[model samples]
Target: MTLALKYAARSDRGLHRSNNEDSVYAGPHLLAIADGMGGHAAGEVASKVVIAALAPLDEDVPGDDLLGKLHEAVVSGNDTIAELVDQDPDLEGMGTTLTAILFGGGRLGLVNIGDSRTYLLRDGQFNQITRDDSFVQSLLDEGRITPEEALTHPQRSLVLRALVGHEVIEPTLQVRETRAGDRYLLCSDGLSDVVGFEKLAETMQIADRQACADKMIELALQGGGPDNVTVIVADVVEEEPQPQATQAFESSNNHMHPVGPTTSPPRPPVQMPPQQPPPHQATMQQPPQQPQKKKKRGRKIAIIVAVSVIFLALIGAGIRYLAYTNYYVGVSDGGEIAIFQGVRGTVLGVGLHRKVEGSCAPAAGPDCRPLRIEDLGATNTTRANEGFPVNDLEAARRTINTWRSEDQQPEPQQPVNCPTPLPGSSATSTPTDVPSLPGETPPGSSTQPSC
Candidate 1:
């Protein structure tokens, strides 16, 4: 089946921002969002430049070339930033996060840099497709912090990577197969940071694309919009959307900076003439139908209840899969090296992970070493405390083995000098006691001296 996108785009300056630094674009074949960072109007310029660089890809592209095109466009945008910075040194520190998707040959080419996000909703399931390039995200991956802690982290807004007028940085790129009913949402951190994931999923379920985008913007503003918010909501459909009135609806009274072709405003309700009863029924009185109506209502309630239960079950299963499939190396309660299955954090006070192997445990095999956390040295000890995430049990074992090899190596000894005896002095004369080198202990002391 031929697939096409029906999309809406919206942006607001938000309550706290003096000017909007976010830019967005939505078209039949592409959707993109950029969140700029810098003081003054430089942020606005950064976002606009990046968005403009990507706007050209909103046309037909071959499936195989989608990723290449996206990468080239992102590099071009980075180059433009460099040129701008050269022209005006004040814009040197300015940069922007980019999250975009290009549709071609019934597939999607996705690229992301910094913290902006892209989410996909299909078959009643919602998931984030792009991982954030941010400090908090790395902490979460290493199990040093939980998702909740990341939200309020002092450096929550610190983006680790972006297109900042310097050397070209590679962006996260992927190609995804699309389905007719799939829906995608691309937005900056302003909306994502404020609105929780559950609320976003609920709003995205709205059938009308425009309505969904509008509700998302409203939710961000309601949540005390601390940054500029931008949103683009698009749905994949088998049939191409027909052209409609070109009127644009403002996202907010404060400011309306929508990019690309905005979806038409909600159409006025059509008035219909009242109809009289049919000729046969006009002469006859209709019987009361409250019982049938009640039966239909009860059936509807039952269906709703069943669907909710199924959805919850699916969500639970997905969570369980995510929790148990991964493994990590960490310090156990006994202060020894250990292997854990599942995530490091807990949910509602229940631990999400379990210690699967302790130092030299029976299941750890003959090569396992009875090593304590302290034996790993200071650097590795810190890593053990944070938990070293691995893809599977084999990888965890490999990590332990590598650490063991490093620990087994002998430390290099420091050289020391001994004074030569005088030619006429007795051969057995005791060496004169001299002050030791700085930071060193004297001879015969518990600590060795540097001569």
Candidate 2:
């Protein structure tokens, strides 16, 4: 399908400006807005040059080809403006903000610089497409001011970047898919800085392209219109068939610009002819048909299979976790007391108060201690009132020490039944003496027990 647009554009001097320095050109596939700056009519000349440079690319540009050609147009406009200023010193430092859009191939390619803006209205919502290259925006970026503060900043009109003099002006370009019923508005700062997005959206919602363009200009004029105001509104529409060659018909004189009442600036209009009689007309009719069943069914099955695989993987993971944490308790012997086999920890709140007995330290090695009581492998205790069972053995020891310090308690006076070689503990022991053959003195010891 060949995509097209119905567009209307206008530029007004406004109440405050001396002569209109803003210029706009828009068509089904071509839309450009430029706001000029400088003294003595130099701004006017620079803007006109930009509009002239971009008017030709509107004919037919593929989506891929749009960015490069649009960039070239900006540079070309800059160079032309620079040459004009060189011929006359009065045109020095003359510059303008240029924003243009080409809509075709079911996409919109945008190129812009300075403070002018382009907005996309889609599904009853409008969004700004370009950022302003101005001092106020710079202040906002630096975090020195809020967006509301910057909006009313006195230096808001001072542009930081623009197409000026002999400098090369390559604009930033953005491309996005265009949809049916989409509407676009391109305008100078005169309209944007004064009129908020909500008000613009309201006007766009109720007005057609021509009415929307006029209303934007009207609002700016009402708001003191401190600068030249310009607006171009374009709406995505289906292209209609063009009729055979016919004579041009002009609109009424009252509708024409006062300066060129007879000259008649061209109207970009497309005329459609009656349904044709040709052998290839069926090919052009766009075949009507019933929907394909196979494609829709295939899509549905793919979604179901993907969802099922994810569900099964989650179920398998849960089963593996339950088998690992359930095992044995404690046991006993003569002098030595063994605790439960495997990692264990004392649960608080056992005796008079709910406080576990034991200080904890992070475990270091086989002899040092394990990080967790579980790392102890297994434990058994001969006496029930021994030290606490801690899943983190070292942590348990530290905790015991902390409690002892806080309570200022002395070591136990009674001989507690601790293991000769403590369970799950590694401590070096002294060598014991043995009698040699009933009569000889021990090899390393001189003293003997009195008879």
Candidate 3:
């Protein structure tokens, strides 16, 4: 069944704001809102210009393609703003907060920058769809301020990124599926500042699209809308009901023992760690050694060798687990970024199963060792990329091949082992102090020759 959208949009010049620096576009399947930002009148001009520039995109396209088009539109709008500012010095620093939604093909494409926001309401729940790019938002993300404090922050309107003073501006884009009975709201900070989520949800639940937009703007005015206000409402309509499992939400599937009907309890929710670890003391005492020092030396060496082999084997197993789980490299314009274990933007990409083993075996060279594979049960795993589903081993292999096609750098057929440092040299097994990703630590591996 085809999914459709019913939407309405409105904008207002708030009580304190002299002019309407906000704009809205509402089509059958397209909805957009922009809140202009500049001390002078140029802000209104910049936002209107962007709205005009993006007025032509088709809303029925795939989410990724819609995102690409929105990105291009933002770039073009940035160029337009830069040219205008160059021509008129008074227009310098003019920018805008943009939040847009294109709903069609049973999906919704979301784009935003600055402080404008998008939200989704479904199943008696509401979720924010856009992350604000503002000083207060960043502070909230870092736990430096509470949500209440952010509402009255001295520099709450200050934006970290916007479409201004440049030839190109990249927007954050997301692709999400939409279903019947789902609702979306797009609004400027002016509305969000005055009308909280609970109130917004209540308004949406009780009113039609036009009434919802009007009521939100009215509430913002009551709270002394110091800035321009804009709001949009979109309702998803599908002819046939679809299963909820295929939506973008994280899965909460319970695990059952392979042999038993259900032996394990449901997994607990993921929780962030505390700031520090609790202290504990060991109670067991070691037995006293009684022997000639020479007699124990050989036994110690044998045990050390066995432990070393076991550690290497564990590392290999971990790598194999990542490989079969559809791990892939996500290359942003910033540089080559890796997405591993469902976390995005790791700096160094680890090739767990490179084909170096096929052409250059370990006998030919140490670097040619075959990649390892491991299968951890489904309960403890997630896909490799941000918003990506986990794939099988065959899919991961194909993805690796695709990455290798663009990576033309020559590889040493044999692994080049780093030589052991001579006596008196500062030596350590850990790699250099490298920075970690959004939610990861630098991998702990030996700098010593693995070959």
Best candidate according to lDDT: 1
Better model by lDDT: candidate 1 vs candidate 2: 1
- Tell me how many residue pairs clash in candidate 1: 0
lDDT tens string, model 2, 288-363?
A: 2422332233234323332342233233223222222222222223222222323234213211112222122234
lDDT of each: 0.74, 0.58, 0.59
- lDDT of candidate 3 over 175-237, digit per residue (tens): 888788988888889889888777887887855666776788788988887777777777777
Q: Is candidate 2 or 3 superior in TM-score?
A: 2
Once model 2 is optimally superposed onto the true structure by TM-score, how far is the C-alpha of residue 194 displaced, in angstroms? 1.3
Off by over 4 Å in 3: 59-64, 239-451
Report the number of clashing residue pairs per model.
Answer: 0, 39, 3
Better of 1 and 3 by lDDT: 1
Which stretches in model 1 have alpha-carbon errors above 4 Å? 61-63, 240-254, 257-451
- lDDT of candidate model 3 versus the reference: 0.59
